[model samples]
Target: MSLLLLAPALLLVGVVFLWPLLRYAWLSGHAASVLTGLVPLANGGANWQRLLSDGRFWQDTLQTLRFAGVSLSLELLLGLALALLLHQPLRQRGAVRAAVLLPWALPTTVMALGWRWLLNDPYGPLNRLIQGLGGSPYGFLSTPATTWLFTVLADVWKSTPFVALLLLAGLQTIPPELEEALLLEGAGPLQRLWRLTLPLLAPYLLLAALFRLAQALGVFDLIQVLTGGGPASSTESLGLYAYLNGMRFLDFGYSATVMLGMFLLVLLLTSGLLLLRRGWQGTLR
Candidate 1:
């Protein structure tokens, strides 16, 4: 009876998730492009082989990992701090949270465009400020050395609020008595956070980590709108590469292969996190 109750949801999941994955796997083995008249032709491992040898693909993969790693770390750290601040009793807490969430709530394209203008060379506000200070206007979006860093900063700025909201919920779940008891025993703020609050909040932290890791790995829109994987492709991600192959280069087969590669990478990382979650749960028991 329970299985019957879950059948519809299970079917939906298969259709929405499983089917696309299966299709990509199958398509990755074929040749489908303008050369092939846009019809899928059995290519038998050719696409995968090309992917293995493609230097650009591997470079993009590395860049994606770096982007995800750095963004995830900063977002988690800053988010925790912001969450802690919000957890305090303050005037107009609701309004404060709304303001904090504004960045995350805005459309990604809108935010990306805003950042692009802010960092634009010569005439942008940042450049104008530099010029005012007797410094040359910096080419933020054009310089390979600084472009990727700005992308990371933009991502962190937009995403940190989301992480803060998750951690704030976790903070609320913690009982006030736990902190009160620690305070009575002469425990300081940092000590109570380390010993009591953090331990209780471990599950929530892990949850947020998993969520951010997955999102960071699959980041697309921000990179697309903000950087466009520019400045000699220093910031190109696997998703952007796949997108270019499929949409720009008209290579469907290779695009499918790239998508599958990204899927495998995400699966491996998320699987590790899941294993860690299990181990943590076992330790709790």
Candidate 2:
């Protein structure tokens, strides 16, 4: 009876998730052809060989890693700080928490577009303030470095609060008796945070990191809306590259290969993080 009950859910998962993945695995082996959708079932390893040998593909892959690395670091730090602030007893605590979450709650595409306008070169409020202060106007989205910075900023802005909320929940779950005991023992705020609080919150911290890093690795909307991989593909993440190939260029075979590669990379990264989390928990024990 239990097995039968699981059958529908299992079937749903296969239909929705497993089927598409299996199809993509098949598609990844095929090669995109100028003649049609794909070259007929390709000779063994042709797609992987090309993917490995392609300089541009490697660059885009590295770009994706680099972007995620930078964004994740920023978001984690900012989120931790915000969570600590919110964890304090303060007036308007509910209102403040809601305000902090607003950025994360906004639709990503709309938020990216909003950031674009906010940082617009000539007419943006930021540029206006810069000019008011006797600085020359800057085309933020037109330069590789500036565009990357803007994208990172937009992603950080939107994601930090989510990290904060998770950490705040963790913070609330901590036993008050432990903190009071620490205070009675003359532990400073920093000491308590580093020695007691963080040690206890390790699992939740790891969980937040895992979630945030995965999202950062696969983020698409912010890049698409803000930069469009512009300024000579400087901000092109793997996801965006695959999207353009599949949707814009109609190179579904190659796109599927890229997607498969991304999925594998994410799994590898996540596995490593999970291992680290286990090690951390062992250390805590």
Candidate 3:
């Protein structure tokens, strides 16, 4: 009876996940002939060889790493601060928590559009505020540096609530006695936070970081709507590049190669995260 119930899920996974992944990997290595759609080319390593020699691929990969790294770091820091703030015994804590979730709750497309409007150079509120403050209007999405900054900020705004929620859950799991013990040992508030609280929060912190890392790596809609990988491909991420190739350019063969590369990179990262998580659990035990 259990097997019967599980069969559908297993079938779904095989069909939706395993089959597509296998197809993508196969297509990545082959050339599509005009008549056959895709055929194994005689050039044994041509697809991979091309990928290796493609300067744009490496540049975009670096950009992706930078994007993910900056966004994750900022989100983790902000989320941790927000989580600690919410840990205080305040009136209207529930309302504050609900408000914090608003950005995360909004659809990505909607959030991106809202940000676009807010950051537009000529009439946007942000630039206007800067101008009012007697500073020159900065291009938030026009230049590469500015575009990256907005992308990071956008990601942080939308995702920090998730990290805070996870950290809040972890905070609740901690006993008050542990904090009291630290206080009794003559530890100051900062000491207790750094020494006692943060150490215990390591697992949750790592989990939050991993979650944000995965999401940031595959970020697309926000970047697309915000910058369109533009100001001369300055903000082109792997996801956007793949979309351009597959959808815009209709180059399925090249797109498959890019997708395969991303799949492998994400797989490696996820595997490493799992290993680290397992190690942390072992240490806890």
The best candidate in terms of TM-score: 1
Top candidate by lDDT: 1
Tell me the spans in candidate 1 whose CA falls farther than 4 Å from its real position.
none
TM-score, prediction 2 = 0.95
Candidate 1 lDDT (Cα, 0 to 1): 0.92
In candidate 3 the C-alpha lDDT for residue 94 amounts to: 94
Per-residue lDDT of model 1, residues 240-282, tens digit only: 9999999999999999999999999999998998999889889
Q: Residue-wise lDDT of candidate 2 within 82-175, one digit each (tens)? A: 9999999989999999999999999999999999999898999999999999999889999886578788889999999998999999999999
Rank the models by TM-score, top first.
1, 2, 3
Q: TM-score for every candidate vs. truth? A: 0.97, 0.95, 0.90
Q: lDDT scores for all predictions? A: 0.92, 0.88, 0.86
Residues 185-232 of candidate 3: C-alpha lDDT, one tens digit per residue: 899989988887887899899989888888888889998998898888
* Model 3, TM vs. native: 0.90
Cα-based lDDT at residue 177, candidate 2: 98
